[model samples]
Target: MSPINFTHILTQAVDELSESESYKGLFHQHTDGNPLPSAHALCNIVELARAIIFPGYFGNSTVNSRTVTYHIGVNVERLFDLLADQIWAGLCFGGDGECNACNEYQREEAAQLAANFISRLPQLRRVLATDVEAAYNGDPAAHSFGEVISCYPAIRAISNYRIAHELLLLGVPLIPRIITEMAHSETGIDIHPGAQIGSYFTIDHGTGVVIGETCIIGNNVKLYQGVTLGAKSFPLDADGKPIKGIPRHPILEDDVIVYSNATILGRITVGRGATVGGNIWVTENVPAGARVVQRR
Candidate 1:
């Protein structure tokens, strides 16, 4: 048999891959001195956040009343340093073309944002406690809060969402989405950081749940698996591009429960104390306390 020329083939492939036109808009030109946002580092950040928020369940298993404050203090200090660097990386990656340099101002802003995010951790924990309570109370399968925290995909997904949401609020770009997406890949639930979710939110069998960007979900809301809060249609702009940043997803009021595989779309509202049954398509506003179901 003839000898195979692997080197020539690999060189040709490399040349093809290096073409500017082929890589245009697909490649990120990393000119800034700071590194790009690290998914690995963000994973560590998430772990630290979980540890701080839910003591003893994550990180150190021996955390108790006497040592809780000490553990949190150490975790918070480490989280601040790690988060500041990642935020700075995100800022550098997404900064304007004119601001290509990794300036001291960017670093300062990243540190300030990280501090603000740390400050919000207590509130985040408070809200997450509500979620844990809701999950425990709502699901017959859940025996305890510890089980919910340790075993449930919903907690993991929601924790990530809350973390990403806070980062988004702090105006840290790229990293927030990356944080949420990491959870999405692990758990089948997808929640956009821009979605406004209130307290006591719980997802039952949370896989396949998709909460779109701009979705406004109120307190005590429960969503079953495969529910999609999405846009019905795109509103095109003058250049025929989908209009950006308009309210496209549904508004789910407090005490609403959406059953599995239900698709609620558009700028419509699912009013307070409502129930949306499984496998239905709702594009219009549903009045408060109403129940929507698929045709018999």
Candidate 2:
């Protein structure tokens, strides 16, 4: 070896071995980073799935039944592979170093669950198609189903929620929250993946809507902008720490319509076909067909 090359190698070795190459700048505060498959990657997968399911509505194409089947088949295969990898990453993220003996078993279980979720895509697409129809038919200015699929915030928000909710149900961790937050950042509609929302769900001008964890939403429910189905904060634990998970958020029965700027907290239920008017603060239950309007 040349003397110069040898000297350079030796210098690098010394610097690294002596800890002179401080990697302190590699990380910053406010990050306890669990490196894994990104939320963005999973988000793209959902986007692709939407395109596949809706075909020409989402992508620029002339989608016949044959093309539709082919697209869905390809998407399903890709979805399975991506789901397995991301779920594995999620398994390792909060649960470290192969975690426990149960971790391996759980990983297999989660994978099976994820595969099952992919299998349900047809059903999900069916329900989502209804959403697209609702959006198109509800809006007089909507030119076509294609317009609703491409431009509506409601469709976008609902798509994200459906994908994230499936992941959450499959016991795939971390990623679901990330996926939901991506939609939240984009649409200003925050629906927790853990929240159970039923079919025919509609959100009009969906900005600033916050649906919390443990919320059970019945079929045909509608929510408007600035509505918060949130939790009531109670006293801290004996250790003076905030509790992680509790049954805290509100529930909406079938056909409920919660309007703009309304804040419904705690375990209250807004019953069937009820219309909660704008700017109302509700902590108590509203019975069936109830109309809750703001005073003055």
* Candidate 2 C-alpha lDDT tens digits along 56-153: 66543776776777776776777777777677666655433333233466567657866888877888889888778766766688899878888888
The top-ranked prediction according to lDDT is 1
Over 4 Å off, model 1: 95-99
Q: Tell me each candidate's TM-score.
A: 0.96, 0.81
| Regions of candidate 2 where Cα sits further than 4 Å from its true position | 1-35, 59-62, 95-111
Q: What lDDT score goes with residue 218 in model 2?
A: 92
lDDT of each: 0.94, 0.80
RMSD of 2: 6.9
How many collisions between residues are there in candidate 1? 0
Clashing pairs in 2: none
Worst 10 residues of 2 by lDDT: 26-35
Worst lDDT run of 10 residues, candidate 1, spans 92-101
